[model samples]
Target chain A: MTDDKDHYIRALFDISPAYDDAPVFQQKVMMGLTLKSWLRQGLVVISGLIGGLYALTQFVRMPEWSLKGGGLYTGSLQMATRRTDATVEAGVEFIDIMARGLADSLFAVGGYVQWMQTPQFFWVSFALCSCILVLYLLNDAQERI
Target chain B: MPQSPGHNSAQDQSDIDLIGRAVTGSHTAFGELVRRHSGALRTHLRRMGAQSSDADDIAQETFMAAFERLSEFRFEGPFIAWLKMIASRRYLKKLKAAQKYLFTDDATLFETPDEAPPPDMRLHDLDSALLQLKPIERVCVTLNFSAGLSHVDVAAETGLPLGTVKSHIKRGLDQLKSALTVPNSSSHPIASSQNGAAGSATPTFMDERR
Candidate 1:
């Protein structure tokens, strides 16, 4: 009886759980890891887009002198504020025209904060987000099948 | 799709290398880690008293949580131990959530007496016998007997009091001895034989026998 008890205890230690279709389980785990990051990935993309738009707005607001010379001029002379050069004034007028044309485009709602508040901009963002969400769900569903 | 230019088979990579790749968004590397560990993790959970489906669910959740926070892994410790820690946390959380219905008094759960086996009974396996012990006792015995962890290590791993851990192990062994009625003269296989199967679940850590 003592040996029998010992053997039983020993056998107990050796029992292994039998899982069916291990590779299938592995594939399922991989599918989950792949699909789980959608929310984080989407947030990263959205934030990156916002940062890019801000940089673009800054680039477009460059002084007329800088645009005429095709380079940024940060010297005090560039900040003189005098409307002496006709070419610089023309460059400034060209920028105003461009900004007005873009008034109805994506970035024209007075930079990121103001643009983010408009219903039209909201709908565009909402549409973009919806598309991303749909695509993410589609990929997840494909993996499931 | 074309093969990733520099990507190699995950089988050849060390765990640290796999973890590095996983942190950089290589899902295949992470998948390999999961394939390597899931079996042992499931076994561990089962031995800890989880039902088969619950064990599988917890294993899945453990891997998902580990992948989400892979960057936080410092690579200084054994990866399996880290995984075990995560699994332990998830198990504790599950226990806490189910405490209201599953256990009437969590502290005194292990106070039940061991059922006696008939004098002439010949035990062939321990599967159903294991389910007879309390959850904590089962966990302590499995970690100590199957995984070859020392009592100190088991205490550290499970975060149970040292005395309590010792008591659980002693009581568990006694109960198992009484419940198992195998023939006294028959030579039998050692308990550590299942170490091979458990090896798949735990990697480097299992090789270091206490």
Candidate 2:
């Protein structure tokens, strides 16, 4: 403990403190996982909602065809193609097939995209689960302590 | 076998008493562990060449890990020795990460003239001289001087054999003494060489109460 004065340790202590990792990174990850969980839940909720809306659509069926000359005669499958528009008349041959095909295509695309997102959904879910596990482990370790 | 709160059949009552008290949610006892051990831990990190910024986090993690594994603290010798080993290993991990990030507390992190340490050499140059040492030399210097750990403790912390720790400490200190004496800065003050006294050879740790 010889005193000569002017040591840097005193100054070293004065130079500002720096932290290695950002303080909020953990909190940000926690919130992101929560938002992702809700979005995934929203997908399932929206599917049920849209399914209910589709059931209501059945009550208001689309006309197979319309006759304009006689002024709005409702149509059926066996009715002759007597629509006013040439395009509508021409499309009569493939109307049912085209409508069914388009609906199928839309559903298929939506399902594929959802399936692709499953891994991301699962990872967010796993992160949340791990946080729970860590919380539990901390409790369990404390109990033993 | 039934025993009173103060008495137990378990081996080494001293360890059991401290651990049992800590286990029973004794805050003061745990605080005892922290106050007793944090200094040596900080020293261990310094040897690992970690930025002081990382030291407290590493120190906190060290205690957290120790408490997590409190059931396993054998308490065979000095608890400081045990803590030093854990902190040293953790510091190595942090060092690897720091290297990857191109950010380290070591004097090596700076480039050129700015890299020079403060001119005054009166205080324990032991810790700062550590910045000049090779990685292995730094670790060795940490275990002996900073941690005040025995050679065995140094070996245990580094996972090197006891003989290796002894040799590194002996050689490392010699090199450190020589390096500190060199006049790196003409502007740097050290009483202009003649006034500079030989470092009285600190006997590793100054904090023995731990």
Q: Model 2, A1-145: lDDT tens per residue?
A: 1121112222221122122222232233234435645785897799678656544443443343222222132244216666546777667747745655665565554444454345675577568769967997996664331
What residue runs in model 1 are displaced by over 4 Å at the alpha carbon?
A: A1-15, A54-145, B1-26, B68-82, B97-124, B146-160, B181-210
The local distance difference test score of model 2 is 0.52
DockQ agreement of candidate 1 with the native complex? 0.18
Q: In candidate 2, what are the lDDT values of residues B1-210, reduced to their tens digit?
A: 776543332222343466667666454455445543454455457556666557656766666666657767787866665666677667765555555422233536433343555676423454556666666666766656544567887777566678867877776666565545533333233211111111233232323212
Error of 1 at B140 (Å): 3.0
DockQ of each: 0.18, 0.02
Candidate 2 chain B weakest lDDT stretch, 10 residues: B190-199
Clashes of each: 3, 1
TM-scores for every predicted model: 0.56, 0.40
Displacement of the residue B174 alpha carbon in candidate 2, Å? 0.7
What is the lDDT for B108 in model 2? 64
Point to the candidate with the largest TM-score: 1
